[model samples]
Structures are given as structure tokens and as C-alpha cells.
Target: MNGVIAGISYRSLLGRRRIWLLVVLPLVLIGLAVLLRAVGNGSEATTVTLMEKFALGTMLPLLGLIAGTGVIAPEIDDGTIVHLLAKPISRPVIARTKFLVAASMLALFAAVPTFVAAYLLVNLESDIAYGFALGAGVGGVAYAAVFMLLGILTRHAVTIGIAYALIWEGVVGNFVPGARRFSIQQWAQTVADQVSSSPFLSTEITIGFAATALLLVTVGAVLWAGRRLRSFSLTGDE
Candidate 1:
């Protein structure tokens, strides 16, 4: 299992295409931040809001979906995943390794940039920058796990992921209080709520509980996807 994981991780790291996507996506987000900072002579509050609502809110989730899908869908589409399945490695192990890879990619592409962008936009007074970045980082991990599982379980993973991230979570979660309670992004915001000193900026959800629940749900989703992948039957294109 370890050998299979190592092989997959190493291959993913060395792959030019994969590495390029990881590097490019985060850089783009950071670049956008820089561009906004350069152009605007706005107040600090304006900058922070822009970074939070735009960068953290939009870019992070989208990047997670892309990275998660990229990690597994290519292998399945090309039928190279059978090579990993044919080994002594259990399907669960392979699924886990793939999920880890996807999560790592999301962290690199979404989370780190989000933090850096926040820092660039806001002062070091409160932990506002840190909190928003932390929230984005956690959300990135959960999003990656869920979307990676979607990739393994269905060919329509990208479409479904986009709909959930954009429509269900992005739109509904923002408008509906109840939906926010169920949202990964909202849970992440709870983390920011604790770190940031501003009462108005604080999340409605409690930080500690949200963090625990987020971790459990993410792990559960990964495990469920692994079990599902084990019995997944790949039929030839009709």
C-alpha cells in the first residue's frame, strides 16, 4: 500500500502537466490580488473585503474543483487506473492515495494563495488575514476530497462538482442561513471568525464545533469514496 501510494504521489509530482496546473492556478490568484492592490487606492477595509469575498470566496472553491478532478479523472479516462488496481494494492488504498494527492494539490493551488492574498490586502493588526486564509485552506481540503471522490465514482464529476460548488454552495449558502450551516465554506469561515477580532466579521457558526464536524465529514467522504471505488465497474464506452 505504501509503495503504491509513493508511486502515485511521485508520478503526480513529476508530471509536467500536473505540476504546471498546480503552479499556474495559485499564481493566477496571487496575481489577481497584486493587480487589484496595484490599481486601487481604496481603504484597507475595501481591500480586505475584496480579498475575502472575491479571492477566498470565488477562486479557492473553483481551484479546488479543478485540482480534485484533475487528480483522478485523467487516470480513469485513459484507463491507466487499471494498472494501479491490478497490483496487490487494495482499491481503498489507491483511492486514499489519490484523495491525498488531490487534497494536497488544492492546498497548494487555493489555500496558500488565499492566505498570501489576504496578507497582501490587509494589515497585520487583527488575525483577519490569517483567519481568512486558514478558512480557505480548510475548505480547500474538504472540497478536494469530495470532488476527487466524485471523479472516481462518475464521469460527470466535473459537471456535478461545478454545480455543487457554484450553484448549491456558492449561491444558496450565501442567501440561506440554513444552507450556510451545511456548507463547507461556512464551516471554514467559522475558523476565520475565531482568528479575526472583528465581531461583525465573525462567523455565525461556532469555530470549535465546525472544525470538528468538517474534519469528520471530510474523512467520512474519503472513506466512503474508497469503498465505492472498490466495487466500481468500468464498462467500455457504448
Candidate 2:
């Protein structure tokens, strides 16, 4: 059931008209990173900051939101999901498959581009490239789960995600110290900070414990979304 649903969702994503827009976002981020390097910043410090702030902070969340919401929202919107539900396949299977496609897409869009961007901008001797990429990858996992559930639970998932990603994480996190702890961006930055040779380029969080918690939340959210999807009533009159 899971395999069939996943296959269908994968094909649906591939057939999307604006799917190429998702591909463009990461490429543009990486291009800007390379351009920043090409311009020859005064120091590597600027490059690292650019990689941390623009690549991880900005690009990852936006890409996650788009990939996450795009996966299921259209089906629900067009009423095609009812056709899938009419089958013997369980709703949980359907949800999980959709999430798998969403999460995989988010990871590819967010993490791989980040690694390429890092390599373009910096030459850290430590495993900074791999570490930040891993952190960003995990961050994408969490975002995909959360936003996918949001897509199921509300009609306003995109708005909520945008508000949370841009207003809460980006704006509030910058101005308020306490808000930083609540941010996906902060958690991801903590992971990146651990890998960078210049720890001063980023701030550290308890990566060992934080990564564990993030993974748990992500998995739990995905499971909860599947359960929610199972119970979702698609009939308009209901």
C-alpha cells in the first residue's frame, strides 16, 4: 500500500507544472553563493556568514514549505484525493507516501544545494561542509513533516508556514534571544556551528541532544499526519 501510494505521489510531483520552480530556488541560492565568492569578499568571514544566513537560514525553510505544501495541498484542493481514498488503500499509507515524496524533495532542494554553496564559498579544513549539509538535511525533514501535517490539518498551511518561517524564525529569532531556542533555523545553525572551523561564524547549540529531539519530532509529526489524514473528511457538505 505504501509503495503504491508513494509511486503515485512521486508521479504526481513529476507531472506538476510549476515543479521546476522548486528546482530553480536552490539553484539560484547556489548561484548567488558562487557569485559572492567570485566577487572576492574582503575575507572568508563574509563568505561564511553568507552561507550561514542566506543558504541555511533563508533558502532551506522556503524550499521546505513549498515542497511540503505542494505535495498534498493540490490533491486536496482539486478533490482528487477522494479518488485515492475510495480505494482499499488506507489513508495512513497515502499520507505517508505523500510525506515521503515531500520530505525527499525538501532534503534534496535544501541540503544538496547548501553543500554546493558551502564548498563554493568556504574552504574550512574541518568537516564543515558535511556537517552543515547534514544539519540542513535534518532541518528539511522536520519542516517537511510539520508543513505536510499542516497541509492536512488546515487550508491555510502556506500562510501559516510562511508566517512561521519568515516572521517567527527569521524576524523574531533575530531580535529576541529566547525566540532563537524555538527556531528550526537556530537548531540547524547549531548543527552547522559544530562543523565550522571558526566557531565564531555561527553559534553552537547542543547538537547531540538537539538532533535527536528534531528527528523525534519529525517522525512523530509524520505519523500523526498519517493518522489525521486517515480521519479527514473530504465531503464538502460535511
Candidate 3:
């Protein structure tokens, strides 16, 4: 929550070419929504499917990886983290600051766009749009925390993140019934189920389980990232 550190981290995150990925993904979601609406396929069922398969399933995790890693990974890779580490600031503070920046970026690029796209597809009269938006926002924060820790723990954070998002979340989580229980996407869908009255928004995970899992994952990842940052060397060795 250090303003100076958060500001620097925000600028650093937005400066990266990965920001374009952030921008483009949401645009694609919205564009698809527009196309669906134009084609008269913007039913509640369709909206739920699009939100579940594309917004929550795909775009959320990808943006989380970019923002989470972009906040600090580039600096660590280029040896510029030494400048931050040399300051009087504690390692946890730096981790917290960068995490805050990443979360805010997720809120903007992921959550807001999700709401807008859902609204375009199904309007705001029902809870579908709001439910999915809230779920996305919560899920984005959790993803940011997890991926930020990954960035601290490994230089190949992006590679690991892509594998997790695509292989684990997109493929396994979708098709494998047992594996869906462990997915961030499904947890978020449980949140959406609790909010939306739409039967199409149901998940095998209950709201209580989803909320608890999200809380534990986000807090645990941030704390672990802080612990890892404490031992990080100036040479970028952990």
C-alpha cells in the first residue's frame, strides 16, 4: 500500500508490451458479445456460456498472468530490482505494493470489461451481468496473487502461467469433472451461481467452498511471495 512503490509498479506494469494483451483480450470478449447480440443469439443461456467459457475461463487468467508478472518480473529479470531492494522498505511491503498494482489492473482490464460485455449480451435487468462481473473481479484478484508469487518463485512465470491457464484451466478443468474442483475458474463460477438466479450459471462447487478457497489462495500466495522476496538476492537468485 505504499503510494510511491504502487505508483512505480503501476507505471512499470502499464509500460510493458503485455499491456496490449490485456487490452486486446477484453476487446475480443466485448466484440464477441456485440456479434452475438447482433446475430440474435444473446439469450441468457448464451450469455452464461460466453461468460463461463471465455471471460472467466480464458481472459481472466491470462490478464492475471500479464499484470502479476509485469508488475515486477521484468525488473527482476533485468536486475533492476536491486534498486528497490536497496531502499529502507521491507520485502513484504514491496510485495504488497506490487500486488495491489496488479489487482487494480485486473479490476480495470478484466472485471469492468466482463460486466460491460455481459451487459451488452444480456442487459443489466437480470443478475447475470453483475454476478459474473463480481465473480470475475474476485477471481482476478486471486489470480493476481497466485501469479505474482509465481513470478517471485521462477523466471519462467509466464510460461508456467500459460500452461496453467490453458492446459489445466482450459482443458482439464473444463472436461475433467474431478479436476474442476481445483480450478479458479470453477470457484468463480460458484460465486456467479450464488449471485445469478440463472440455472445456467450453476457449478459443482458451492459458494462456501469457493469463497474459502479463494480467500486461502489469495492470502497464502501473497504471504509466500513476501517470504520469497525476503531471500531474493541482488543477482536475481532466490
What TM-score does candidate 1 get on C-alpha atoms?
0.86
The C-alpha lDDT values of all candidates are 0.73, 0.76, 0.91
- Report how far off residue 84 is in candidate 3 (Å): 0.5
2 or 3: which has the higher TM-score? Answer: 3
In model 2, what is the error at residue 107, expressed in angstroms? Answer: 2.2
RMSD of each: 2.8, 2.2, 1.0
The Cα RMSD of model 2 versus the native structure comes to 2.2
For residues 138-172, write the lDDT of model 2, one tens digit per residue. 88888888888888778899899999988997899
Off by more than 4 A, model 1? 1-21, 39-44, 233-238
Which pairs clash in the backbone of model 1?
Answer: none
lDDT of 3 by residue, 1-238 (tens): 8898998898787776777888999999999999999999999999999999899999999999999998888888889998888888999999988888999999999999999999998887469999999999999999999999998888999999999999999999989999988899999988988999997778888888899999999999999988999998767676
All candidates in order of lDDT, best leading: 3, 2, 1
| TM-score, ranked from best to worst | 3, 2, 1
Q: Ten consecutive residues with minimal summed lDDT in candidate 3?
A: 10-19
List runs of model 3 lying over 4 Å from the truth.
Answer: none
